[model samples]
Target: MELRDISRRVGIAAGVVTVLALAAPYAVLSGGSYASQLADYYASGVVGGAGIALFALLSVVVVASVERGNLDPGTLAGAAVVLGVATTLSAAAWATAIEPSPMFRDNLWLVWHARVVVALSVLIPVAAAAYARELLA
Candidate 1:
């Protein structure tokens, strides 16, 4: 079709590829070694898994925006629902970090925090998946 369209697609693809490539290792490392992973994330030693996950998410959203940019407000509203989940996760992570309760110190709350963060994070990925399906359709 058009050169501009081709170039834009190529650029977006390149960006997605670069992000995944750079971030995948960190995610793997994080999964294998939690302390090292958290240190890396905290010290900015590498891109955090959360950041990469968000990038993957936004990538799919961009795809949807490019393809079915005219989706009804209903779908947009569905997407917005994830924002609350994200906020909750962010808040939990922050609160626990700032003032660790005895519960948090006991590893029980830590597990809960991790579970909530992960579960909350899935909301975006799932939405992004739906967006990708609609876009690719």
Candidate 2:
């Protein structure tokens, strides 16, 4: 497997995971189910805007990283860095807040988010290293 191929796969996976995280339940309230419509809720806020931008950038990077018989190592590396930051933030939040919250004790969305963050954390470093190696080679 080439560095480009590996990075392209990771980028795609990261984008998918981000989408899943956004769709996952963020909160649950009495008399209303906010968790089910996380994206709709977050879509109107500053944080939501950032998330949207991140997803857009990631999608572009992933698509650009894997072109017709060509590879963009720099773009792949950039994507890896973005994924790394996202993973760190998500994992830290999960460990410090989500897992300890009484409301999320039985939340499947929390579990899904946690799993995706872990996957992203692992993928980011591997993709970055591969891209770096390819560049050096």
Best by lDDT: 2
Model 1, position 63, has a per-residue lDDT of 40
* lDDT score of residue 57 within candidate 1: 51
- Clashes per candidate (backbone, < 3 Å): 0, 0
Residue 68, candidate 1: Cα error in Å is 1.9
In terms of TM-score, how similar is model 2 to the real structure?
A: 0.51
How many Å off is the CA of 9 in candidate 2? 2.0
Error of 1 at 44 (Å): 2.3
For model 1, residues 10-117, the per-residue Cα lDDT tens digits are: 434533553454343345445543555345433331334454345445544554354455876345434533542443355345334433334334344343443344
lDDT of 2 at 105: 58
Q: What TM-score does each of the candidates earn?
A: 0.34, 0.51
Candidate 1 TM-score versus the reference: 0.34
Q: Please, what are the lDDT tens digits per residue for candidate 2 over residues 19-97?
A: 5554444424422544444434344333342454364346546544545436665665555556555644544444333
Error of 2 at 2 (Å): 2.5
lDDT of each: 0.43, 0.50
